[model samples]
Target: MDFAFLFIDWLGKPLWMWLAFISIVIALLVFDLGILHRDNREIEVRESLALSSMYIGLGLAFGVWVWWQLGPESGMNYLTGFVVEKTLALDNVFVIALIFSFFAVPRKYQHRVLFWGILGVIVLRAIMIGLGTTLVSQFSWVLYIFAAFLVITGIKMLWIGDKEPEIGNNPLINFMRRRFNVTDEHHGQDFFVKKPHPATGKLVWFMTPLFMALVMVEIADVIFAVDSVPAIFAITTDPFIVYTSNIFAILGLRALYFALAAMIHRFKYLKPALAIVLIFIGSKIFIADLLGLEKFPAALSLGVTFAIIASGVIWSLIKTRGSQEAHSNGG
Candidate 1:
């Protein structure tokens, strides 16, 4: 149809490209909710792995499509951003797991909270990326600030090491408790339920722990975005590439969560690898300046980043193998 080809430019990208991306995403979500996860049940590691593989495959496939349509440079940038965002989101998986445990969210209902949470993330990420794109367009010098921020954040992560979050004393949890009516227990998958007010004896909606957990997870993603958004901006300021890569990475997160949470201990080395990745990405811009290069080669950047992550994963597996065996034996 002529309608499909009548492309008006949106943010330097054609309407058709945007429409294609949106179409794929919509199809994936429909498949995810309507078909694959038609019934909410406890997702075992095997099922999680299967779903994760599908999402990861689709994300990479989109990169291939980018390569074909937009040429190698943009394609490489998309892949780089995708890899960076996916790895950065690993840290978030830890916090989400903690929130779920603290709220005592049953496995069956966990998907429901996470599914609705995706809707929030789609809107939230769009706003952040749109703002970031605007800032970069208006003030080109902002890239330097992003680079500096990434370097500092990476160094801070190295210094602080990994520590489990203390959810019991989280200020947000405390604030929510003080400000609203919170049920003492989860009400199935419901985020809210109508119950009689203690003082007024009038029916009022009370938030369940599941809802609070969802809120906390959303907040956690926002916090992580502070690090991730800058890292992606440092990679390439293309709004289309940035947004697509970020959303694709996030689309798989819930599926990845089940598999990763169960074996989080095996990823002990991933944090340092991520820190190094951030530092490398941040430093590339400055390094290009000294070398009189327009920009670092996208292919080289992607290769180095992937190599670092692979090394970290392999080393973590080898180092943690004994501990895993010991735990199994003891059990």
Candidate 2:
């Protein structure tokens, strides 16, 4: 077979780079599902932390590779995008927990839903990032819109603070229930199960609560992506850096969910920090324009983003130490 196509450019990067990233993601998923978790079981917090750490290590290592292969600027952009995406997804954890709780999904089966949900996310993010690239390439001014949207969203987040999503009142859930043949209870790890129709007394396919939970999780990611995609694009319009950093960050965050979901309430200050980060990220473009610079310094952006998130995490840990103990004792 001719290997010339591999060097052909696609979305501002050589096709081989995209293929390599895809191959790595597939291998990681196979290892995670086939080797590590062939049997359905609850992921303990310690195990979750370890798995998440491995993913994070791999993500950062990929950044190092980008640094060696690309340049320091690209590396900084990747790191900043990764940090911003990962932290932005912290809010997603709370929503996932709420989805699982609302659907009454068993702890052991939660990983199944999330694993499948990741496949959906991969496709969804690709579509979104692709569209974003197209728009930005064609209409240079669209970045301003994205930047403005981020600023408004950041302000809204700051004003609203942490409000638990009203999962039960969601229209999508209601619509699914009204439109689909759904079972009132979970059927093990199955999203859909063949069963006799209740009214017609004929064999039919029925969606379990597990499936609904998975759908909700997918939707939640899409919703959150609206914020994160633009945020990353603002950092670097290079599709390769944007997509790779996004996937890596999400892969790690999904692994981290089991640990974070259990203690999501402890991160009380994180929302505010994330809001500030958004405001900072969004304002960078305008700030650079005001300073008559082509773009903001990637190093400064990375440093500021890291410091803000680290401060939030540290502050949350300190403030919630007593709450953690109380929760343990109460449980």
Indicate which candidate wins on lDDT: 2
Clash list (residue pairs), candidate 2 = none
TM-score, model 1 to reference: 0.97
Estimate the Cα RMSD of every predicted model relative to the unseen true structure: 1.3, 1.1
**Prediction 2 global C-alpha lDDT:** 0.94
Model 1 per-residue lDDT tens digits across residues 124-219: 999999999999999999999999999999998888888777998999999999999999887887899999999999999999998999999898
Residues 1-331, candidate 2, lDDT per residue (tens digit)?
8999999999888999999999999999999999988999999999999999999999999999998989999999999999999998888898899999999999999999999999999999999999999999999999999999999999999999877789999999999999999998888998899999989999999999999999999999999999999999999999999999999999876679999998997999999999999999999999999999999999999999999999999999899999999999998
Residue-pair clashes per prediction, in order, are 0, 0
Question: In model 1, where do residues sit more than 4 Å from their true spots?
Answer: 1-5
- Angstrom error of the Cα, residue 186, model 1: value is 0.7
Give the Cα lDDT of each candidate.
0.91, 0.94
Query: What residue runs in model 2 are displaced by over 4 Å at the alpha carbon?
Result: none
